[model samples]
Target: MTDRSAFPRRREALAMLAAAALPSAAHAAERRVATVDWSVLETLLALGAAPVAAPELLQFREVAVEPAVPNTITDLGLRGTVNFELLLLSRPELIYSSSFYVSSEPRLARIAPVERFSIYAPGRPPYEPAAAMMRSIGARLGRSEEAERYIADTEAEFAGLRERLKPHAVRPVIPINLGDTRHFRVFGADSMFGEVLKRLGLANAWTEATSYSAMAPVGIEALARMPDAWIALIPPVPPGALDVLAGSTFWNALPSVRAERVLQLASINPFGGLPAARRFARLLGEALPAERGHG
Candidate 1:
């Protein structure tokens, strides 16, 4: 029953399969793309233009939670550190990045052509810039129409939220992420949170100019100045921050804290793109309705 003639053909088929899996200089027309930037990665997901490789999907899934990533993509490793070997194995035809990886651009170019996008600028809100980045990435991926549609969809959602949240728009929202017991980072008008809150027709409580996006390690005492605003406590809350706050006199004395006007929101990446704007807006909408407390 052993057909010896088929043996040679079977071995040849196996060799071809192995070659296809390797990072060789060949393709079936579809190009590979890799990115170390979460913003780029999430934008790609929104456009249905998944990259061949991305970094930190594990953590990204928890924080950004929008336009879900595909299951087939390769994880290049941690976002803080790039895994050069894994990236090489992925054999991306192109690599998309943000300013955070500027120093590594030269090295990245060695493996594939690299394109960098910038969204954060000191003075202006990044909403338009973020949308521009999406359009740019979509053009690169040959998904320009999809990108425009996604941007339109996101804007439409915000427009709808602006109407839905009109009732609870009485008080401004002060968004803060606790760094520890003593201090927290506040989102200013230039920040994405501040920008989204504005788009939703709600005022941002913190009006001071931020250095870039958020001002970190701000003293807790400063919150006492704005008593009527709603304090939106963002998570990744330090190990025992809540218990610590429960026992502190100053924390209890803050009117927002005492009146239970604090809205506990999920982790929304402060530097994300349109998808992030939608995520933050949706979370606020769901949590701001009746029975809104400790959420």
Candidate 2:
């Protein structure tokens, strides 16, 4: 039989080992992170991780509505000219970015570990890359479970939207960002908006070739070609775009415009991940009933 006195010593030893295995308080406090990409920032927020700093924080607020950023977080400045001085001063434990800013990685690494994530790749589905980025960022931040849950929840949300959109599935929709009265950026099969449309069981009307941005700049005449398709314009529409187009003979001639089959959705981040996809899905669901009546 074991000695009774030795049992107390064994229990004390086990407790000490467990305590040593746990993360120290100081180490836990060092989890602060920063991001240079808005989509990355949004994904981190959705995972319940608040980045200490992010680029273009104000613009992110203007464009992205969900997964809101807190005012306490510092802005790292514009995307094209990130304030490196401010970023270094923040002393983040990690810096998240994308390949578009790969040139700055070496300099950024002087302050913290820099992890680059890509949400757009040649010949790949938009949602796939976005999901991969979410999982990767989540794992790095120790929030893998949250990432998976968010993806699953988003899929469920899309599924519900798909069911609700069944009646209007036959309506081909074209999503565009109206650049001006004369020009617009139309989304194609490779865009995040296109993926959301697919998941919602809606057909995309713009099938033209495009760069990795998955959109092409086209004129108002382009809409005439898609006569049967409804136009879903992303808002904060260029100032006076509607008023200007209203008086133009070209805009009035489109069969869709004549039928009033146009919808103005809330601002959506075309480059965002699961959160953005969910937002687009909900927007489509809300607008479909009206679209059907107009069609």
Candidate 3:
């Protein structure tokens, strides 16, 4: 009548049920995960696992190197966005993404277990979040060793470039996503691109505050200030835009522009995971002028 008499029996029954269910729970935890960003996809690939689906596989088609996993991953659209309906249909075990788009859309969790982690956060200084993300994702992917190796290799390569560039006295470098000859977004010290520049021992010309990328748009008026700076154009644009930039006075008048230091890199997501960082190094080295070729 006191009801306390039934509590002991209920606890015993629940304990028994939990003990019986532990094995099934362990099995359920082993489901594979898929990611939308190329960085995460690269991390997973390095970890010896492939996602069920990924967007823009062709962009990193060389790195992925494996045939598509049948009935698993489906390419929905571009990076930073996914087709929710297709995502639901794909039935990923887990979905990984950056903080920007993921936090903006919480409804994705309804389809699968969406693990929210900030690969990069807005307004944070020093850009430590990116390296933290790499280490965290590396641990998750069981490839922390590979991640360390990559980090070391990148640092070494950067050091070599620094030595090569020192003779010429490395100057500030402004990496711009050339929207046009008149307007451009200059990368600040907060971006991965900026970090790559820093690794090469080049200072970022823009010292102003930045949001996510620490990137702010400026007009050609600012170009006059960075006479010794080299401009790295990003996203290797269409032929028409290239031609227009090639012919514009705004592009022609700068010191670095005249010295043939300006170069364009193909559009690859510089944010996200380890592969992104590695790819950045590879792309930068390829785009930069050789020691003999420089002034």
Candidate 4:
């Protein structure tokens, strides 16, 4: 027969032990995260953390090529107007966003801890900010080592790509996204694609100042200015934009188009991090001809 006083002490001991084990058990459960930006989602996936939810997932699939998001994750909504009710129901442990969406931080904090990551700043290279963002997010997600490895691997890959693309090092290339038959968004030095071009030892034909968005909306006449430039078009070009451009005398007049010095890359997120940089490098290497001649 157990004494009542001893029974009470045993119960207290059991409770203490259980309390002590609670933290470890909680740590074992993967943290649930929700990302409000595609870049954050890409970085999290690269770090081996699957977010519980992300915004614009369908659009992300169309633009972002690598580090695919698993179907288990929920789509909260678009960037500007996320479904707060659905977000609450998801019960995320953390919410990651960008500085562009800071207005929603206070509201997001009510549900979970909110972290805002800034990837672009004045007077800094795009890759510098992107690498820093990866490390910062990685440390928060307990993936610091993986983040370091990713940066190192990207650098190694870039070095190899540089050697492989040495023949076209002097070639000036203009990367453009078609907005319509008459206008296109030309990527310049401030863009992620610009950084990739620099890494490959290629020159950007469009030297004019561009918005922080890294691209400038210009008329088709702009392409005519860089007659010696190789035009690289991003895939999934606006529906019928090319067909319309093909008929335009302004488009056919460009020396690049006439010489067949144009390359089309597989879908790549220009705003993504290390994985995107690697993808851009590989694709450009494959697209460029072995010699100075056209592909």
Identify the candidate with maximal TM-score.
2
Where in model 1 is the C-alpha error above 4 Å?
A: 1-31, 290-295
Candidate 4 C-alpha lDDT tens digits along 74-186: 89989888999889988898898887788999899999988887775443457887898899877777678889999999999999988887777656999888877888888
Query: Per-residue CA lDDT of candidate 2, range 105-161, in tens?
Result: 888898898889877665455898889999887777667788999999999998888
lDDT per prediction? Answer: 0.85, 0.83, 0.64, 0.81
Tens digits of per-residue lDDT for model 3, 1-295: 5899899999999999998877544233324565666656666665455676767766556443332233345776766667777777767777777565565357667766765556554544333555566566566655577667766765777687767665434566677775565777776766777766666666777777777774545786677788877677776353577788678887787787787777676565645454555566566667666763345
Candidate 3: 10-residue stretch with minimal lDDT:
62-71
Q: Between candidates 3 and 4, name the one with more favorable TM-score.
A: 4
Task: Go through the candidates in order and give the clash count of each.
Answer: 1, 0, 2, 0
TM-score, per-candidate, Cα-based: 0.86, 0.89, 0.75, 0.86
Q: After superposition, how far is residue 65 of candidate 1 from its true place, in Å?
A: 2.4
Please give the RMSD to the true structure for each candidate, in Å.
Answer: 7.8, 3.3, 9.3, 5.5
Q: Which runs of model 4 end up more than 4 angstroms from their true locations?
A: 1-30, 291-295
Better of 2 and 3 by lDDT: 2
> Which stretches of candidate 2 lie above 4 Å from their native place?
1-30, 290-294
Q: Least lDDT summed over 10 consecutive residues: which range in candidate 1?
A: 22-31
